[model samples]
Target: MRTLRRSTRGRIGRIDSRDAKTGIGAAELPALAGGRIERVSVAREQDSVASRFAERIREEEELRLSPLAARSYPAVRVRPEEDCALRTPFQRDRDRIVHCKAFRRLTHKTQVFVAPRGDHYRTRLTHTLEVTTISRTVARALALNEDLVEAIGLGHDLGHPPFGHIGEEVLDSCLKERFGEDFRHYEQSLRIVDELERDGMGLNLTEPVRDGIVRHSSRAPLPETLEGRIVRVIDRVAYINHDIDDAVRAGLLREEELPREPIEVLGSSGSARIDSLVHDMVEHSATAGDIVQGPRAGPAMAALRDFMFEHVYLGPAVRAEHAKISSVIRRLFEHYVEHPEQLPRDLAGGDGTAAEDVASRVTDYLAGMTDRYCIRRYTELQVPQAFAR
Candidate 1:
């Protein structure tokens, strides 16, 4: 009987030198001298649908997607992982963002209006969906990677705090005054995905998705990928038009009050304006080989944006609530600052950690709250139990 020997790797060694020369492993050797074959398999794994699915998507993307479009095959995650059987990297990223707890909290967070009584008003979650829809439409027209665009669009505003921009503004001010640091929703969004989510392990999202989320704002640096660029531009397009609809519905602005010249150049209604803008963007970006808007529609959109800021965004209607929102945020900030033990254990470092670190944790906790939750917590802290009930 042939004796079996173990290799240095703890695997079965070749039965003889002849098997090594032939490149055959011990598994294939026939039994001899009345010994049964062990049949230790040594062949490479066979190709199948599960193994080839992602590669097929990459090949299809190479054929149909724009030359400048980002590819998902070579996904760059902060931590490496195995490829999914069915979803491309960006598709997987979209799934992760959708499933995460932060994304769910968006439903109760403010968009333009803070806690509107009417159900039709857009919340942060709806805004995200709108941006993703518009971005996908533009991406499809441009032959860009729609999956990447969708992922970026969905994640771009995940960092926005409750009470809309008012909450963000107060939080920023509180941080600067108390800790000599500043806060921005975009930066916080990056931190959430990189360090805060999943009880501090983050989402482990791909590099492109993370980049698109943090750079979707015009105030931030431009994104590296064309898909991210699409989201950056479309976010404004989605918000400006939707905010107008919401404003009119809230009786804060009349459709006729819109700037005449810009209205004529773009369109009278929100849908018409979006259509004109999308068409202009498609034509201009195709020619420029980058996401851009034509002169007329570009200036028209900008004019509309300016008009919104003056009348709807920063105007009397919304500003009236500013003081109330500010008080809620500042009071909460001070309360947490004086009592770091109230922070979640994951965010709160050890007792020996720096005060600045604790302040940062407070910021994260507050920023993650929904609009109603923020107000509820504020009431619970400030109001007498009899009055609160």
Candidate 2:
């Protein structure tokens, strides 16, 4: 008979791991990455696909503590090889993203405020941090991959043009009509890494992180993992409440303007609204098995999201600004696609290929424009800035 050590991690439930280096109790499970769920069904109870999914989830969590092969792959990363490097491949990607110039520039970009003329409002940098904050918390709590989640959160905004979505819409409409709907931020993000970053380092992020970021968009998306789902929700959570705050600051929205029902459901203060949202999302994803509207606070949160879109996102003043910026971007696209030489060097010339290929190269050049650059280009082309003689 084998002598079994007493179970320190009571939650394993005869799962048997006296050899298990990391004893995982229920408390440990909740707190693993930052309060993520990490339980799998007992090995003998594999009766259905749903159970298998849960088991697979549990296995992933277990992988974090497990030691890799006897040797390390140094070319694969910048960090040194260690027995249990807390920083995984995905984590390296996160650090690289943080160090990148584009990530740092987010501080000057807008979240809601146009000029952001103040320091306190949510800039793109603050928004990214907020998303990271919520994404890590949810990923840790669900026992999903925190490194991948954080990476997704970090990479999610990499493709954002200057002045927030206003810049994107501007570029999209401008480039799309003539370029045949070829410009979108997600694909551009993929481009930044493939062709743009540091003469093409592209960050070389892992597959899961790429998938999460590609599908994070709301419209016409692709399949993704649990980490991606968390990112999708985090994007919404960061924008919805923050937009309301910005609108209020810009005097477009008033505390009194909130519809009574949404106000009750979302709470008054931004922090309270965020708390309600995060708690609701965690509860829903745990119980309903997805973040879609369902029992356990899902419906209320959905209502609040919708109320935000109606009262805040689509409000008239913002739409007018979106239109104005969109026009500027479109004009630039028309001008550049015709005079491709005027574009930046890397963007102007590509291997001979499809006409849209040329347009794509042009779009690549144009999309990278800073808000100031785009405005300057508009001035050069329209105003004849070549010195009045």
Each prediction's TM-score versus the true structure: 0.87, 0.72
lDDT by residue for model 2 over 157-224, one digit each (tens)?
A: 77777667767766776655665574567777666654566654566766667777777877637435
Q: Pick the candidate with the highest TM-score.
A: 1
| Candidate 1 lDDT tens digits, 175-248 | 99999998899998888888887877888999999999999889899999999999999889989999999999
Candidate 1 deviant stretches above 4 angstroms: 1-47, 348-353
Q: Please estimate how well model 2 matches the true structure, expressed as its whole-model Cα lDDT.
A: 0.65
Alpha-carbon RMSD, each predicted model: 9.0, 12.8
Find the candidate with the highest lDDT and give its number.
Answer: 1
For all candidates in order, the CA lDDT equals: 0.86, 0.65
Where is model 2 more than 4 Å wrong at Cα?
A: 1-86, 220-223, 288-296, 348-354, 384-389
Residue 16 lDDT in candidate 1: 49
Candidate 1 lDDT score relative to the true structure: 0.86
Model 1, C-alpha of 58: deviation from truth (Å): 1.7
Query: After TM-score superposition, what is the CA distance of residue 68 in candidate 2 from its true location, in Å?
Result: 20
